[model samples]
Target: MDQLAAMATFVRAVDAGSLSAAARAIPSSLTSVSRQISALELHFGTRLLLRTTRQLALTEDGRIFYERARSVLGEMKEIEEALAGNRREPSGRLRVSAPALMGRLLIAPLLGDFLRTFPSLSVDLLLVDRNVDLIEEDVHLALRVGRVADSQLVMRKLGEVQMIHCASPDYLARRGEPQTPSDLAQHDCLVFSDAPGVATWRFGRDAGSGQRVRISGRLWVNSLDALATAADSGTGIVRVPSWQVERQLAEGRLRRLLREHEPAPAPLHALYQPSRLGSAKIRAFVDFLVERWRGSDPLGR
Candidate 1:
């Protein structure tokens, strides 16, 4: 059995969602496709896929093998591309993942120009407010905000995002603005789960002289949009990323407070696997973003 061909066939079956679909894509007979899958299962000593008339589902071992197969295939592609000097003229489907808000507001706006510049390239953008593993998810690159915990991936700094404390004019009028980090205790704060410091707000010019303020709130959620909306309606003051409320602050719908006490800016990064460091698509996109955000503060200076 040709191992690599069998693996490719298995991957195609998973991608196409059925044996018949895979056969159609490969321009081979259904029996040939089934033979490849059967060979792979026999070689592995476990079933890789479960098929019904309607669909194909991966068993637990199948799921694991699929991820490993994808990673192996990606590495093989990179090796072939390197040998062919494809880095100079990137031409493939580049899958990118990014945070939902940033992807929609910042990254998405720039993609059209990049695509126009590189007509040979196509992009698949995935935006969600969560972390994505490059290898596991088959993501070619990612736009990550704040600290990146993955040490294996190579990170390129694009810019920084500011975290701001702000409130609506009505809220300030009724409850008064915080004069210092200490004063936040006397006011109502909108809280969100999974926030960097959900119960403690840290402020400083640098780590050595930082102020830590413990906080409580009447509202708690995981949605940044909802928190901003509540703050707009005079519900409470919120400490959040500036991009979420930049327009509100500019149009007088929200007022920034304790700007001097705001924490250090969160760094934005473009992350990719080290093996993809030589990829033209990754380099081009990262360069475009750095140039686009240079000397510009998304939080409104």
Candidate 2:
């Protein structure tokens, strides 16, 4: 059995979740894929996957090996691409992840230009609100907004995204506009439960310098799109990233409120694992995005 081939097959099977799915991905038969995984397990003298009737789960050892295998495969691919004298051209699969709303409104538009420039490059964009493990998921780059906790990953600050408190004109007319942060308590506030333990809306800098306003609301949502929708329908006032509500504000669907008392702008970042940073494909894609955003008004500052 070819150990390298078996390892590659095993990694694919683990990622695809099933032998049949992995076979289909590699354009091979299920039997062949199964044999490849079995050979890998035999070679290593341990069962890598715990196979059940419904699903395939990884063993602890399998999980560790899977991560290492992915890194090795990525490095191998990079080496082959470099040796082939195709390093100058961005020709490879690039996996990217970003927030759903921001991905659609901001990043999606830029992809067309990127693809045009590098015709041989293929991109898989994962639009999710929740944070994903970049190395574990094999993602090349991730566009993140707000504060990032992972200091190990390489991060490049693209720009700052301002948080704005906005409400529909109709809602303001009926409920009246709030003059200060303290007045928000009396109004129905649309809550975004994306961040945990946010029972009270913390406004301004610190505990003393900033005022912690405990606001109540009937609507609670996890997605920015949903929260923005509720605010547009005049459900209540919502504090969201300015870019998310910029279009609505321009169309008069939403109006900014308490501009002077708004929280500090959250910095947007492009994060990637250190291992993949040197790869031509990864560098080219990130540089392209940075350049594109640098020229735009939203990311320019």
The number of the candidate with the highest lDDT is: 1
What digit string (tens of lDDT, one per residue) describes model 1 on residues 105-129? Answer: 7789888998998898899999988
Shift of residue 151 alpha carbon in model 2, Å: 1.7
Give, for candidate 1, the lowest lDDT window spanning 10 residues. 292-301
User: How close is every model to the real structure, measured as TM-score?
Assistant: 0.84, 0.78
Local accuracy of candidate 2 as per-residue lDDT tens digits, 9-118: 88898888888888899989989988988888888888789987557999988989899898778867866665655437878798999988889888899889899998
Which pairs clash in model 1?
Answer: none
Candidate 2 lDDT (Cα, 0 to 1): 0.83
